[model samples]
Target: MKIAFTAPMKPLDDPVPSGDRTMGRLIVQALELGGHEVRVASRFRTWVKEGGDAAILTRETEGLSEADRITREWEAEGYRPDVFLTYHLYHKAPDWIGPALADRFNLPYAIIEASRAPKRQTGPWALGFRAADDALARADVVGALHHADAECLGAVLQRDRLKILLPFLDTLPFETAADLVIKHHKAPKLLAAGMMREGDKTRSYEVLADALSRCMDLDWSLTVIGDGPNRAYVESLFPPERTSFLGALPPEQMPQHYAAHDLFVWPAIREAFGFVFLEAQASGLGVVAGSTFGVPDIVQDGKTGLLAPEGDAEAFAAHLRALIPDPARIEQLGEEAARHIRFRHTLEMGCARLNAFLETALDNRWQRSTAPRRPHQSSGQPL
Candidate 1:
């Protein structure tokens, strides 16, 4: 199947450290691997970052044409993808462009990792929400990674149309360092990765600090693997010497860090779907996450890793303390986590499910439109 994929926040090839970008690239790779054609719709910002690549799309051509241009370009080429898939769409590029493109091209629309917060509805933002509502209403499939998102939007959209497609990690690269990774293991080390945002205070740096204070009582070291605005604040909360804020490492360099750590700890509150959990799990790290969002869907309590109540520092610290001493259990959980991801949450699995959904949606649409039905007169009687 040919797919027109767009991501408003970041393009697949954009040189930005983000979960959305990571997932976008993985999706593209997975679809290609699954024997499908995928074309990424790059935005001006992405092209600008690439220097000469900016020439492919002119500023005026891009700015002047608007959403209709996408359909026109596709039609001009005499090619229309079976589906228009968008990722991390908010009011920005998603609401306006997606519906227009879908309506113009007459194709199934699918959105991945979408969100709707009612409080955010006001002024110009209100229009975005309305557009999101329309898109959701007309969408053939709305892939939700987190349960909260599904619950929030389920009231508006058909429940059957919403499928839980958890963001997965690509673990093929991590296979090379099997021996070296195991070698770095000593006392239990916990790892947390991804850029931090302070407004939500969701990364749970405060919880990490408390965990460390209690971790000294237990035999373990905590390693935070990403950087953001919350870095300095979080780092300051912990002993500067003990906690390592390695900023953001290259994607290739990440597996080594994961390998060095024995466990993964993410205390963020209300996550959409923590892809880091999948990554950590894929790297064979015992998982620890806050019990909110789709995290429960990923981190099976006592099976893959432990779950702490959202923002509960003492409880999080306690769980880590208990798990640190038992290497056998830790190894067991890590193995299970990896196995679970390989079986259920791999990019391959996600793409296959997506493909199946598209096929079903198209078939259903055809059936609905074509099936024989009784004609009703203006008086409401069947003719």
Candidate 2:
């Protein structure tokens, strides 16, 4: 199957520390692995540490228009994809054009990782939400990353049509210095990676700090990875010497950072699906994330790792402290986490499922289109 993929708000090829970028790359790879041709339709841009290339996507209508030009160019080449795929369609870039294009080409329309909130009404964003609703209603399949997201569009989505496709990991390639898990230590190193925003995450971090303060009797260190606008402020609060800030590293080098630590902690405010937890679990580390959004679906509360009370830093710290003494549990849970993710959450599994589902959907469509037309009948008699 030829898939026409589009990510309107953020370009599919955008270089950023984002779940959307991760999912976009994963889906493309999955489709390719499933033996499907994927043509990503979005404004192309190459990100530089200095800045982005203006020639790629200018900050004006002209930039978006150029994207549309490329979409048309593909359509002109008699290459209408069998299915039109769009991910992360929100108020920014609603599927005004993508859906219409799908309809014109007689292809199945599909959406991945879309969300809406009723409280976000009373603004231009409302218009975008309504449009997203329409696009979702028309879609033949909607792959929701979170159960809450599936509930958000419950009015239109068929239960069977909505598949819970969790966030996937390609598994970063890295060389470990040593089996840190084997090393005997009095203190356990807790690792976390995410943006340092002041919302729920910052508050959670503060709570974790407070919890850790309460457990000063225990030996432990924290490593906060990734950097953002709030870096200076978060760093000011949790200095590097105590809570080392490693900023961001390339995806390939991320696993080594995780392997160097024993556990992963991320108590987000409200996450749709925390891909970082997936990455952590993939790195053979036990995860302790909050119990909100789609986290439970990712981290098995007890088997894979633990889930603290949402925003309860005390609970997080208690859980973290408990694992410090239990080297056997860490080894057991870490291996369990890796096996669970390797089997269920790999990009290969996701893509294989996606390919099978699309092929089934296409086959259903063909059968419906070519089925024999029955003679018109009224009540109990044929006309």
Candidate 3:
């Protein structure tokens, strides 16, 4: 299958330390592993950072034109794709290209993790949100990673058309260090890795710091691996002497950090299934995180990791403290966590699910071609 892939959030090669960019790259890698011909359709991003009527209108106009131009350029070269695949779609970074290009070229369209909301249709992001809705409305199959996203989008689109794909990555890199990582098992070490940015990330850091401070009886050392605009602020959240900031390390060098730790701790406040959580699990490290968003889908409470209620510092501290007294339980959870990821959330598993979804999409698209074209119908509308 010749798949034209694009991500409106960020280009796969973009030099930005974002989870969205990482997810985009993973999707491409998964597609290629599934034996599909992948094409970088367009690198033109449709990310709307700020919200305002005038800003959105201008963005919508320009973004739409840019998408069309890319399609026109392809037409000139007599090249057409079998399907248009977009990664990561939300109100902030709406997909303004895939749907328009697919419509132009008369091909199947699929969106991976495209979240939708009714209220967004009439706000400052009115145009971008609608464009995103249109794409979801037009999608032959919508791949959803989070259960919450699926539930919200199912209200607007066919629940049957929404296929669940567990977020995944190539864990082989980390798997290789399993033997060496086991040796770093000594000491009550905690690992926290993510972009130390404002909003949810900062909130998570603040809550975690507070939670750790509450664990006064527990003896632990924290190693933070990330750097962002709010690095200074995030660093200040933790105890300076005990918390060692490792700065940003490349993905290739991350397994050592994961292996060296006994527990992966993070207060996942409204996270859409953090990839780092999985990476840590893959390295056979137990987790201590907040139970919210898509986190439950990954971290099995009381099994692979002990989860505290989202934003509950005392509970989080208590949970960590509870685990610290019993090192055997933590070790068991880490072992189980690694096995869990290997069996369910590896690259091969992710590719198989995606290939199945795409096959279904292609089959449906072929079936639709036999009938007369109908006007685009969207089950979701602006409230």
Candidate 4:
């Protein structure tokens, strides 16, 4: 199967990277791993943070031109993709290219991580929001990352088209790293990594600071990693002597960081599922994160990690206080966390699930004459 991949929020080669960009690149690789030939549909980002009437019209025209250009190029090559797969389709990042190009090529179109909200039909981003809703409605199938998203997508996509897929991470890096489960700890060393932005990021940081301060009676120190616009503000929330900031580390370096730390603690407010939780568990570290959207999917409550109520600093602090002095419990949870991620949340597992869903989505429409589409390159490798 030849898949035309596109992400409206950002390109696979985006410079200022985030979890979304990483997910986009990973999805393409996962499809390829499933023995599908994939190509980038367009690099032009159709994401509009917020725009009024005039700006909306301008972006609409630009999206059409970009889609037309890709259509012409693909037509000239006499190549028609079996399907078009768009990643991260939300109002803030709509599928401005994939839906249009898929319609032009008369191909099946699918989306991953698509969300819809009717209330946004009239806002500064009303145009983009409508476009996203239409794109999801047109999809032959949509892979939802969370139950919340699946419920939301129900308004736009049919039951047959909605596939619920949990947010996942590539666990190979952490799986191959040296284990830190046996590390000695007189005072547990906590670790957290997240960009320090104004909205959710800063709020999470502030919540974490409050939680940690309340746990001062416990024996623990901390290390924070990540850099962003509000570094100074975030750093000020913590005691300078107790916290060591490592700034931002590359994704490749995260496994080692996870392995070096005793506990992974962070308050993820309304997160789809923090990618770091999976990474930390894969490295055999117990986690303490706020109980929010999609988090319970990644962090098994009693088995792998502890989850405090969404915004309860006292509960979050108590969780830390309970775990800080208990090495036996930490090791027990860490072992379980690692095993959980290996069996359920790895990239290979996610790819296998997606491959099966895509085949189902193809339904009876699939035929061997689509054979020239190429041999099934993937042998259904184990994740």
TM per prediction: 0.85, 0.84, 0.93, 0.92
Compared with the true structure, all predictions reach lDDT values of 0.69, 0.69, 0.82, 0.81
Report the alpha-carbon TM-score of model 2 versus the true structure.
0.84
Clashing pairs in model 1, backbone N/Cα/C closer than 3 A: none
For candidate 2, lDDT tens digit of each residue in 185-276? Answer: 45678888887776766776676666666667766788988777777876776545558888878777677788888788888667777888
**Quality of model 1 by C-alpha lDDT:** 0.69
Clashing pairs in 2: none
Candidate 4: residue pairs that collide: 35-378, 226-247
**Local accuracy of candidate 3 as per-residue lDDT tens digits, 120-235:** 87868777787677778888889889787888888877765788878987898777776675454455888998887779988989989999998766778899999889999998
Best by TM-score: 3
For candidate 1, which ten residues in a row score worst on lDDT? 374-383
RMSD of 1: 7.2
**Error of model 2, residue 298, in angstroms:** 0.9
lDDT comparison, 2 vs 4, better candidate: 4
The list of candidate 3 runs beyond 4 A from truth reads 184-186, 371-383
Off by over 4 Å in 2: 44-71, 172-182, 239-241, 360-383
The model with the greater lDDT, 1 or 4, is 4
lDDT of 2: 0.69
